[model samples]
Target: MYNKTIITIIRGALGMTDCKRLMEERRSVNFFDAAQPLTPELLRQIVELASLAPSAFNLQPWRLIAVRSPEGRERLWRLAQQQPKVLEAPVTLIVVGDRGAWQGDNPAWGELAAMLGGAEAVKPYLAMAEALYGATTERRIKFAESNAALLAMSVVYAARCFGVEGHFMSGIDFAGIKQAFALDEDEEVVMLLALGYAEGGKVLYPRRKRQSYDELVEEV
Candidate 1:
């Protein structure tokens, strides 16, 4: 019976059903049930999935400073152009970009690379990575900020899959937030996300359709 069950699992492995139905159901939920609070484990799970997003030269540059304190939330609300959601949401994350994560040889990358390939095999790649990404300060900051935005989107998508409503907010004073959090001046503020359960049925504005694939995409 165990062997049969294993066979059944293997048979379905390659053709496993997609979660696209859930994806289609997900929308930007502006209204949140503030009473239905999210737990740390759930937040960690969502972040874990988000952290899997792609980055240039494999430099994971995103940082999430989650705010839960009442005082802090109030301050955030004021900074967020006085948005009520900042105070009402169960969890608010301050997404930051670590602009210097890859400029130097990051220990995390070194360890992972060494584990996958030998240390000698990894040195040249690191050298090339540093030269390309670390050649100038501007290049580094741009790539890091870009990566942060991508990761932030991944977090929203991941939270949606986790059955949590995620709202991307850019209504805050970036400099004030950095100062409040004591973040490095050079670190870029990508955006913020409020995660919680959906409240009353959200009334969404009509979404603008995208350009046709042929119009947007060019075949080489």
Candidate 2:
């Protein structure tokens, strides 16, 4: 039998094998039931889970704008190559990466201090963020974007646990979205995820094939 402690940890952190089944069963649902939209509380919980993803120096550069309103969804629809799913889905999250996350020390360090119990507890982490991620603009931006990508995937996985399905879109007009949303110039739009319940008693196919463990893994 499995250790109860280990099983509890798994379930607490990311839920049981059922959560895995949710991910496996989920598909890139295009036709959504906007009428069956996620409640505000549920949306908050999903985003909360997505935010827990790790980031370099704990900067947590990800910023998600959930577009659930009529006008906002319409704008996204136009920016996203006229994809109907943009309009059909109840919420479309625009995940952005803030390149300037490591530029300063006050707010970020303040958060770290609170999280770690005191300023003294996380002073070294603060210094490390400045030393490593603050080296150059390119480094900062790359770190932010990469971390944001991790958070983006987490959003999908987290949403699935709530019986929500999603489809991530690419080739979006980043510039237009920036202009539309008035995002900071230093913020890069990483990706967009359309989220909602599937419509018309939707059925999903098997998860796409991935490289087998032997094919993708290597031992040193």
Candidate 3:
């Protein structure tokens, strides 16, 4: 007998599976206990898992900067509107989308082509990515931002599986973050995530009401 409910609960706790119950259970966590730091290995695991998020043409056009060092975190804090959560959390991820992925000097083209059967097969895909996302400056940035947004959500859920919580935010000096982080001109910061463990056990806020299926879905 497969107890899916119980299984989901356990797997969700481990951050191994994406279940609706788990998604519903997670809330924006603030006030992380900085004393309870996340190990480097654990942080790596979470990022690697989240990197599996699908992207257009397998470009995976996002760059992640995990500010774990004290000095780095301090620099990031200054750019992030001096948010207390940014300083209190053990790690803060500067998630950005690189619009340069489709342009020249891009390595993803070679990598994706290798998987699908070498350069010949992937040439068209490379062209398509460029044509669609590289049509104009606005289109390029928006397409890149949309793809990176997917990775951001994946990261939030992946953190939950490791008993870690996150608070995703966008209120910041965008230019400051890029300057502090040395982000290239073609790269745009999508969001920042403060990651750490809660001081007490299970400090989940009450689940908020969401749009009903009827309101959310449409039967065509």
Candidate topping lDDT? 3
Question: Least lDDT summed over 10 consecutive residues: which range in candidate 2?
Answer: 1-10
lDDT of 3: 0.84
Model 1 has an lDDT value of 0.79
TM-score, per-candidate, Cα-based: 0.82, 0.83, 0.85
Report the candidate with higher lDDT, 2 versus 3.
3
- What digit string (tens of lDDT, one per residue) describes model 2 on residues 65-113? 9998999999889999999989999899999998778755437668767
RMSD in order of candidates: 6.4, 5.1, 6.9
TM-score of 1: 0.82
Worst 10 residues of 3 by lDDT: 1-10
Candidate 3: list runs displaced more than 4 Å. 1-18, 201-205
lDDT of 3 by residue, 149-212 (tens): 9998998889888888888889988888988888988898889989998767746667678999
User: Clashes per prediction?
Assistant: 0, 0, 1
Q: In model 2, which runs have C-alpha deviations exceeding 4 angstroms?
A: 1-16, 114-124, 203-206
Deviation (Å) of 152 in candidate 2: 1.6
Q: Give lDDT per model, in order.
A: 0.79, 0.83, 0.84
Candidate 1 vs 3: which has more lDDT: 3
Give candidate 1 misplaced runs (Cα > 4 Å). Answer: 1-18, 116-120
Ranking by lDDT: 3, 2, 1
lDDT of 3 at 182: 89
